[model samples]
Target: MIHSVGNACSSGEKRVRMPAVAGAFYPADADTLRETVVSFLSEASSAEADKEVQAVIVPHAGYVYSGSTASEAIKAIPSDAVYKRIFLLGPSHRAAFDGASVNNAFDSYATPLGQVKVDREVCEALKHADPVFTYVPEAHAREHCLEVQLPFLQVHLQHVPPIVPVIIGTQDLAKLRRIAQALQPYFTSDNLFVISSDFSHYPSYEDANRVDKATGEAIESGSLRKFLDALEKNARKGVPRLATSACGQSPIAVLLLLMEGRKDLQVRHLAYCNSGDAIYGDKDRVVGYHAFSIVKKAEADAFALTGEERAQLLQIARKSIDYELARKTDLPYDSTKMSPALQQHCGVFVTLHKGGKLRGCIGNLIGFLPLYRLVANMAKLAAFEDPRFYPVKESEMKDIDIEISVLSPLRKIQSIDEFQLGRHGIYIIKGEHRGTFLPQVAEETGWTKEEFLGHCARDKAGLAWNGWKDAELYVYEAIVFGEEK
Candidate 1:
């Protein structure tokens, strides 16, 4: 299903314009670049794409420094997104400029892969907002700020929506605020907002990590004032070039302001890397790249676990296991053991216990199994195949505990603000081993959300201490039940 829609030549075969930078900046060969892009996008999961994403912040450095990270963000984009226009904003790294300059080309932006159409309607609307918004091809022509992201978009979205590429050079907060505010009404799941800028450019890998982490935390918290304060603090100390390190600070500020109206802001860190992490490996001076998606959080499905329902689920798991193990036959439970409507959804987990100790837990994150069948199969696996314990001795059957979590399908969460700590269970898996605990697990363990995830990545997945960032994470709710106290 992955493909590059356009060819190396210009729009149609009627005319051709050569790649402006070619090998100097991006890959010269269309096929090589296509393959690289495919690999990157493939790494992102579309499971959450059914939920509309509000906006995304990605780095616009050369593909090598930021490509992989950027790919993660794009891949995370809900495949079902029906954006009509893409408003791309990036900080000007080229010659000094003032105001917002839109790329004034009738022709689509030509890439080795193909041309991405310009959204004339959006472009025209923006120009009408402020006189400073002028048509300037010179500003966007060789600008890697906006150009680099084009191919990534082309590779993923079937509909190549028109683009409004803006290069930010002036640091006038009022102007930037006005521009973002004006454009805010235009943003919807059907419309996309792209902000491009790298963080902590040319800092030592260690220092870049520290400063960038601060910036990222600030963004996640949705505190524009704090982010700006950090920049101001450094500037006040006569820290020359420190503000320059975060080149896209203005664009980020605009995004922060626009997102203010939205209460739900889950900024998922898709990928992050610097030159030091690249295969080419330049640790001495590194440019930090981060890709994140912001979206409005949909209200989670409301399911109050009635005492009757809890009792039914526990009995079902126990009987299902006993029937299979002892009677060597299928257990006949109520046809509505779990809601059929819920089964049609994805992301369910089953947990089994014996003598009040953990036994086996298994789940299909995307919700392939019906709620009832998922519980049945998982109960068996937890008891016999968990690998953590000897086969649940027949004698231990009386002491086993069973819990089933009928999870609400994961919606692509736009904002972390939507996440309720005690309401969601988290799972982090990468490579072979995986770590997961139900939502109640965190409450029981007295761990904060971050601490719980970190432990799951480290202790459960057997990954490095900070492995959560690179891990595949799925968050869900559990209809949990166990032996009555």
Candidate 2:
């Protein structure tokens, strides 16, 4: 039976949810809670926060057991990005009901750090959108899954974003689907989703590691079918001793359903550990914890270079090629004349063409260094180091044309439909083999989309002709500029 609490209050009065597990799950004193969270965050390696993160999966366990794993996910939020609202989803451990519970009674959620306001407008809108969403105060009253995540949020996020705290009470897949469908419209770039879960509960340490590894792989694959299949397989292997593969399975399912066809979002595994590894835990029985983040693919135009910037890169490439042909050890360059944009890190390729034919080409797929430095290095390599052709001679310098391709960050695409022959370059990876083709390859060869993907898979990636169907495919756009044009 489900009950709604705090609805009888007056209009002007705000309902506040006082912490239920303050001293038990985490520190009760504000100073201690702050210090504990700070230590966990400080110990975590700062992951590169260059992408726009959309969602994250964190473990909900006692601070002593899973706080370090949770900190990895919270710290992944880019220090610059701010969200207007945070949708907190976690399965109900203490209550059971027919549908999801939205805490309409609470205006703010309180932790030792302070209170975070509830987005009342969003909560009201969700209640109206689906009959499955109810104002069930009891479902959230004693729930620890959602409450444990707040202290970490309070410490990591720049401005503590207002939250719409939800406790998922039903394991019905259809109901979960409907809930995902109802919330689909609100899944925007400015809103963040936090799914709280702990994987593989109460198994022998060895069995827990095996089961959790399979679960993690399925989640990282970004295929809902794979995740469900893996969950079932793991559950079968973990027999009488294992209670469940994941305590928060229902919440994780809802998140997978919500992200079904989103090509822009990519899942990254952040950290993993088990209770047995903790100082307080016994090695005989353990609970597994894993952290992951969903980040948006960086757009092509977000880092576009200005016209003047493009000219400078082209000039640098041309001069470097000429210097290499002249047998000089270094290219002539003036750093004092460089623009600020030249200092930005960017992946670049330098191509040498003569009479409209490809002579030599070389590049760096990942931009680890400054843009200007990459251009200078790749320019010499394209002219002198490309294995397909001999080094360009001084006599041929007058006939050569220099072209530059500046790439946007690569994004993993969900389906072949996401790729356009003339607009997007393709990158394919299967096992240890990898391959790439520029956007211009299609235009120059006049190949259809399928042909372009097939050649890249078979010839370039050394996989079967249809290997892309099962392989990981990434797409990016390039700003192609040449001296002739």
Number of backbone collisions per candidate, in order? 13, 0
For model 1, the stretches where C-alpha displacement exceeds 4 angstroms are 1-19, 44-50, 234-243, 300-485
Using all chains and alpha carbons, the TM-scores for the candidates as numbered come to 0.57, 0.60
Q: Which segments of candidate 2 are over 4 A away from where they belong?
A: 1-12, 238-240, 299-485
lDDT of 2 at 300: 26
Q: Residue 390 lDDT in model 2?
A: 95
lDDT per prediction?
0.68, 0.82
TM-score of 2: 0.60
* Consecutive 10-residue window with the lowest summed lDDT within model 1: 1-10
RMSD of 2: 18.6
Local accuracy of candidate 1 as per-residue lDDT tens digits, 180-200: 655644554557889888887
The best candidate by TM-score is 2
